[model samples]
Target: MLVVSTGDLMMFGISAVALIVLAYVIQKTRLGRALRAVSFDRDTAQLMGIDSTRIIQLAFVISGILAGIAGVFLGIKYTLYPTLGSLVVKGFIASVIGGLGSLTGAVIGALLLGILETLLLAALGSGYSTIAVFAVMLVFLLIRPQGIAGSNVQEKA
Candidate 1:
C-alpha cells in the first residue's frame, strides 16, 4: 500500500495549477501573442509595431520568476547542493523525447520518462536504470530526431 502525504499532494496541486495558468496565459493573452510574435521574428514584430525589446525584457523577467519558483519547489523536495543541477540532464532528455517547441509534448514526455525510469528501477537497479534511460534517449535520437511530437520543418530558401 502506497501512502501519500499531504505535503506531496499540495506540491502536486501547486505544480498543476501553475502549468494550467501558464498555458492559459500563453494561449489567450495579448502579451502572450506579442511574446510569441517577437520570439518567431524580432524584426518582423518590430515592423508590426510590437516593441520587441520590451517584450524580450518581459520574457526574461517571467522566465526568471518561473525558474525561482521551480528552484524553491526543488529545494523543498530535495537537499540543496551545487551538483543538483546535474539532474537537469533528465529534463533535457524529457524535452527531447517530447519534442522541442511543444509544451504539451514536453509534459507528456516527462511523465513517460518518469514512468519508464521507475519501472526500470524496480526491475533492475538504480545504476542500470540510469544507463537505460540514456540508452533510450539515444535510440530516440537516432530513430526519431524530430521527437515524438516534433514535426520536421523545411527551411525557406
Candidate 2:
C-alpha cells in the first residue's frame, strides 16, 4: 500500500507553486523577455542593447538556485547519497521526452515518465522500471526525435 503524509502534500504544493511562479516569471516579465531573446538570438539581442553575457550569467544563477531547491527536496524525500548525482540521467531523459528547450514539455515529460515508471514497476518489477523507461525513450526518439513540444528545424551549415 502507498502512504502519503501531510509533509509530502505540503512539499508537493510548494513545488507546484514554485513552478507556477517560475512559469510566470519566464512568460510575463521584462527580464524573462530578455532571457528568451538571448536564448533565441544572442547576437540580435545584443544589437538591441541586451547584455548577452549578463543574461547568460543570470540564467546560470537561476538554474543553480532551482537545482539547489530540487536537491533539498530530493534529500528530504530520499536519503542523500554520494552517487545521487547519477540520477541526473532521469532528468535528462525527461528533458528529451518533453523537448529540450520547452519548460512545459519538461514538466509534462517528467510527469509522464513518473507515471510510466510507477505502472511498469507495478506490472513487471522494480528491476524493470529503468529498462522500460529507457525503452520508451528510445521509441520516442525513433518516432519523434523533437519530443512532445520541440520543433524540428533544419540548420544551415
Candidate 3:
C-alpha cells in the first residue's frame, strides 16, 4: 500500500474521526450515564436498578465496532503487523494527555496534538515531533493537573 511505502497520515485522521464519534455516543447517551454510574460506584448503581453487566457488554460491543472500523484504516496505514495499534500510540497518548475520562478534553487534545505534530514535523522534522508533543503535555501536567475543563468537583460531602 502507499502508506507502507510512505507514512500516510490520512488513514490515521479518518480512523481518529470514526473512533471519536463512537466515543461521543458512549459519552452522551443514557446508556452512557448508566455506564458512568457503574464506574463511579458499582454497588450504588446496582442498588438503583442499573444492570452493570449489561452496560459492560454494551461498552464492549461499542469498542469492538469502533475498533473494527479503525482496523480498516490501520490495514491501509501499515502492513499486517501484529502491533497494528502501535503506530497510533502517540495519538492515543495525546487523547489521554489532553484529558482522560473527559471526552471533550480528549478531542481537543487530539486536535491540538495533530496540529502540533503537523507543524513540528514541517518546521523541525518528524524526528522531533514526538518530543514536542510530550514536552507540551509535560508542561501541562506540571501546571494544570486537572487538565483543560477538568472540574475540581469532588463528590458531595
**Local accuracy of candidate 3 as per-residue lDDT tens digits, 1-157:** 2233333566666667776676766688888789889777878899999998898898789778877776776676568977655657776666556676676777778787778878899898877877887788888788876677454535643
* Cα RMSD for predicted model 1: 2.0
Q: In candidate 2, list every pair of residues with a backbone clash.
A: none
For all predicted structures, in order, the TM-scores are: 0.90, 0.93, 0.73
**What are the per-model numbers of colliding residue pairs?**
0, 0, 0
The prediction achieving the highest TM-score against the true structure is 2
**Could you give me the TM-score of model 3 versus the true structure?**
0.73
| Best candidate (score: lDDT) | 2
Name the candidate, 2 or 3, with the larger lDDT value: 2
The 10-residue segment of model 3 with minimum total lDDT is 1-10
**Candidate 3, lDDT over the whole model:** 0.74
Cα RMSD, each candidate: 2.0, 1.7, 4.9
Looking at model 3, the pairs that clash are none
